[model samples]
Target: MLVRTGGPLAAVDPSEFTRTMARVPTPVTVVTTVDAAGRPWGFTASSFSSLSMDPPLVLVCPAKTASCHPAFVAADRFLVNVLSATQSDIAGRFARSGQDKFGDGDMVPSEEGLPGLAGAVARIACTLREVLDGGDHSILVGHVTSASVSGLDPLVYHDRRFTRPEPTPSLTTAG
Candidate 1:
């Protein structure tokens, strides 16, 4: 049975919308960039995706209030470090507001000259392409210049919790 009773669909409640979106799984990554003074800045982001292949483009969303937002917006290059399932602590450290996120000293200079986490599942170095307004966050598009990936599972976020994806079973045939 179906019923139609409204001229337009009602707007979704913000909290309910958030709750619904939380069920969708996303990869956790740390977006890093160096400031003009040569200081490293970074933040954890679950909103990242590949947009193009011919141009090798990717995008990440950083909130306006993020501590490293200004630096990332002004920088010419940045690195997206795809976290491994074992790196939840690193993700938590970068997610905080006013703390020494890099104080633990597990970073090395990436090929792009930005700080990269030591044990990431993958690293993508990119040059800034564009910045677009995205309400409370900014959409940053980058042209990937260099990238590397390790044979490891990535960290994931779903329902406001950290989780790891299960590997699919391989097909085998008995001779």
Candidate 2:
């Protein structure tokens, strides 16, 4: 049996870890929320996924060093916009720091009053459930309150590039 300890795990180079993980395809998203003063804040993230169904939960990880981290940490609610295949520009812009992220992404106010990408393939508006500490990011667990889907192709990130999935022909047996 393997041993479990309270000590830190073996170290691995962050660059290598990132490069390895980049091989996996992930949906690109821009998570948005409002600050205490009602100012909009958001960040692009690929580390998001559905966590549960019974209570309808989703989680997104925002880097702790991100400029918008504090605002998200303090937000009571937030919106997660799953970018459409054509919205790679929005993903690129939101990933940077100290730039106009919402300038040309066709962002509009969501019904919940949060900044929302109008071209999202899906939109999930959630109430803050909990925030847990991940290695270099905060894992924000959200309780989904409302959601919408457009049935559009989603922007996918793979091998450090943005791409979309191409549908494969299905095989069916004739009766």
Candidate 3:
């Protein structure tokens, strides 16, 4: 229950906040970047969205505690790969900490050398633009350099699980 005493709203419990957030379906993405030594780093992220169109920008939040966070924070560019529902296993691998994330996946390197998933439904190559504070996570803003879509249904996360997005049939006009 939330009670407003005429001042500020009561602080919501973190667990409750998490539960409430789970109700919103979000696309599953694997954001990848490399270290100074050229070692690849990646992680599964559901906290992602397009932020702008004119200048082309996107945002993704990676927890500060993520093992690959440092690599991303240091890299000047990264790739955002929206996975197809069939890649749930790949998403699971990236979501885990201290595991080999790219070993079995269809990892491919772009012309500019950024690592990305081969069969991603959508891939956005971005130049790291800005970083903002987001409490436990860091909000990374990227300037889109190039983007491509595979015309496939994307995987999504909801209620703490990954599921295929069922496409709704488009209606025809009664012409």
Candidate 4:
């Protein structure tokens, strides 16, 4: 447990803080976009979440240092591909720097012209709704124009490794 003393939070080193934060499990997702020349580009991200239901907004954060960051920022639209446990390899491919991540035979084009990875649990197509200029990373808020789900289990990340969730109560209970 993380115990908090009465005084100011003890100064922890950056590596320690990063490793500590990595302990929190996060759902894996692939953020895909088109570059200036209309070529496909994308990267894997764990920083994604639904923001609003009525407006159907979603959020994703891409690191400033990411090679595909410019492509995503420049694109008018993008797709958030939620990967399943079987897609850990896909996520790893996109996470690498300076490589033709999509060269693998797993990605396909979506109806909306964005690249969609095969066997993804869910794909959310969105237009760039907003961009918040955060330090070291940019927070992208998207308006979900279209979406689809495969109804499969989602892949997860924790402590710099891939993980899968244990079976839980289903939305439809046994009758």
Count of residue pairs whose backbone atoms collide, per candidate:
0, 0, 0, 0
Every model's TM-score: 0.91, 0.90, 0.91, 0.87
Model 4, span 11-111: residue lDDT tens = 88989889898999999999999876878888899999999999999999999898788877877899999999999989999899888888886889894
List where candidate 1 sits over 4 angstroms from the true fold.
1-10, 171-175
**lDDT for every model?**
0.94, 0.93, 0.91, 0.90
Q: Which pairs of residues clash in candidate 2, taking residues 3 or more apart in a chain or in different chains? A: none
Positional deviation of residue 168's Cα in model 4 after best superposition, in angstroms? 2.8
lDDT of model 2 at position 9: 83
Q: Which stretches of candidate 3 lie over 4 Å from their true place?
A: 1-8, 172-175
What are the C-alpha RMSDs, in order, of all predicted structures?
A: 4.7, 2.7, 3.8, 4.9
lDDT sort, best first: 1, 2, 3, 4
lDDT-best of 1 and 2:
1
Candidate no. 3 TM-score: 0.91
Specify the highest-TM-score model's number: 3
lDDT of 2 at 2: 100
Instruction: Give the poorly placed runs of model 4, Cα more than 4 Å off.
Output: 1-13, 169-175
- Candidate 3: residue 144 lDDT (0-100): 95
